[model samples]
Target chain A: GAGVSQSPSNKVTEKGKDVELRCDPISGHTALYWYRQSLGQGLEFLIYFQGNSAPDKSGLPSDRFSAERTGGSVSTLTIQRTQQEDSAVYLCASSLWMGGPEAFFGQGTRLTVV
Target chain B: SQQGEEDPQALSIQEGENATMNCSYKTSINNLQWYRQNSGRGLVHLILIRSNEREKHSGRLRVTLDTSKKSSSLLITASRAADTASYFCATDALQGAQKLVFGQGTRLTINP
Candidate 1:
């Protein structure tokens, strides 16, 4: 796809289970970001991968949330021991540079933990 | 905490009427951008205003930035039913790794 691509548009999981979401960024894009949006709420930054630099995980809600970008292209977000509170739409975006430019977004993965 | 906060959580206007959304940020920013999302899906970039730029225009969309005030506004002229969507303001902070921080967003509805 020319734009950012996310896998498993919708996922339903049991509480305490784990799930993984995948994202494929645009070709040659150096920056990728993950954000979580709850129903009727704003997006919360989760983690960011920029080039070869370390990812900034300041926005991660807990240790259970972790993400990795392999070869600076495809990325995966893993949630361990998912809780009801983890139910939300996970959005992925990619940009040509680190900042100061428009970003391309994926359709997002709606995860429901019952 | 989110860096940007949008005003008027929800808005509805008649067709042909202009709609405006405002966003305020907590810190210095390199640039501010507006995006629109439909049905909580992928968001499409609308416009971007750099801190050095006071205002910019793209088609019927106008964006204004006030660096000193740390605020920005997105004005859509000639509203249409197709324009109904959730609009969010994202800021590229000057500090840190220069990641974009998003605002809660404004839900705009246009009636024909």
Candidate 2:
């Protein structure tokens, strides 16, 4: 089975610009999550979606950061007015459900804000 | 915010040696999981231990959970060079939100 996939393995953008990263989860996966990993830091939760219900946006750092999952399949994470501090690897993962199941991850989009 | 903290940010050992990593969390959890990530790659789930279970094993990997202490340990016996990667522990708090809080991770280097 194909695993999770993300687009734009590397992205370089100027400060204040907006960037959108895409993630394609595995087929039949009902749970999707986004996280950010900074250098020498741990994984920071961003947002999560389960099925077509409203997403759990509690982890989103600010209003500028938003994510949407369409048709319960693909998801897009948008960072508006990106800042240099937002530079990090954006990771996407999908699991069968939110419980204690294994999560499959994508290669991630490494965004660099210059 | 990160929920777990892994001890010993980095470790180095020869192949065939046993490697042990520990993780401690602040809150009660329904289950704990361990993952491995290669350089520049996404994380791969290694094992999961529920709160009721004390210890579990898979191949050469061993995971132990201590709910009383809110801590867990992962032991890799006879580690190979390929096991040289980053290890992370994630916790699913008892709240049942389904979101996992990950640790800072441990970088293990195995010399062949």
Candidate 3:
């Protein structure tokens, strides 16, 4: 796809189970970001990955939340021991590079933890 | 905390009317961007205004930036029913890696 691609458009999981969301950025894009949006609320920055540089994880809500980017391409966001509060649409975006051209977004993955 | 905060949680107007939305930020930003989301799907970039430039125009969309006040406004002139969507303002800080801090957003409903 020409734009960012996210896997499992919708996911339903048990409260104590773990869930993994995937993101594939546009070809040649070096900057990728992850954000979470709860119903009727603003987007919450979760993590960022820039080509080979250390990802900024300042926005991850808890120790259970983690993410990784391999080969500077595909990325995955993992939530361990998910809680009901973890339900939200997880969005992924990628830009040509960091802080420059506008980023392109994926449709996002809506996760529901029951 | 989110850096950008948009005013008027929601707005509704008829077709051909103009719509305006405001956003305020706390810190110095290198740039500000507007994005539109339809049906809560992926966001589409609208326009971007840099700190150096006070205003920019893209078709019917006009954007203004005030650095001293640390705020920006997005205006959609001659709107249509197709314009109904949620608009968000995001700020790229002067110092950070290209991470964008987004506001809660304004839900705009344009009646046909």
Please, what are the lDDT tens digits per residue for candidate 3 over residues B1-112?
4379998899999999999999999888888999999887799999988889999999999999999999999999999999999999998888755588899999999998
Better of 1 and 2 by TM-score: 1
lDDT of 3 at B26: 86
What's the lDDT for candidate 3?
A: 0.92
Tell me which residue pairs clash in candidate 1: none
Off by over 4 Å in 1: none
- Candidate 2 lDDT, A1-114, residue by residue in tens: 489999999999999999999999999989999999997677888998988778989999999999999888989999999999999999999999875587888999999999
User: Evaluated with DockQ, which candidate comes out highest?
Assistant: 1
Model 2: residue A61 alpha-carbon error in angstroms: 1.3
Which of candidates 1 and 2 is the stronger one according to DockQ?
A: 1
Report iRMS values in order: 0.6, 1.3, 1.0
Top lDDT prediction, candidate number: 1
Q: Report every candidate's CA lDDT.
A: 0.93, 0.91, 0.92
Superposition error at B19 for model 3 (Å): 0.3
Regions more than 4 Å wrong, model 3: none
Q: Residue B91 error for model 2, in Å?
A: 1.3
Error of 3 at A93 (Å): 0.4
Pairs with backbone N, CA or C atoms under 3 Å apart (clashes), candidate 2: none
TM-score of chain B of 1: 0.97
| Model 3 Cα lDDT, one tens digit per residue, A1-114 | 588999999999999999999999999999999999998888899999889999999999999999999999999999999999999999999998776569899999999999
TM-scores of the candidates are: 0.98, 0.96, 0.97
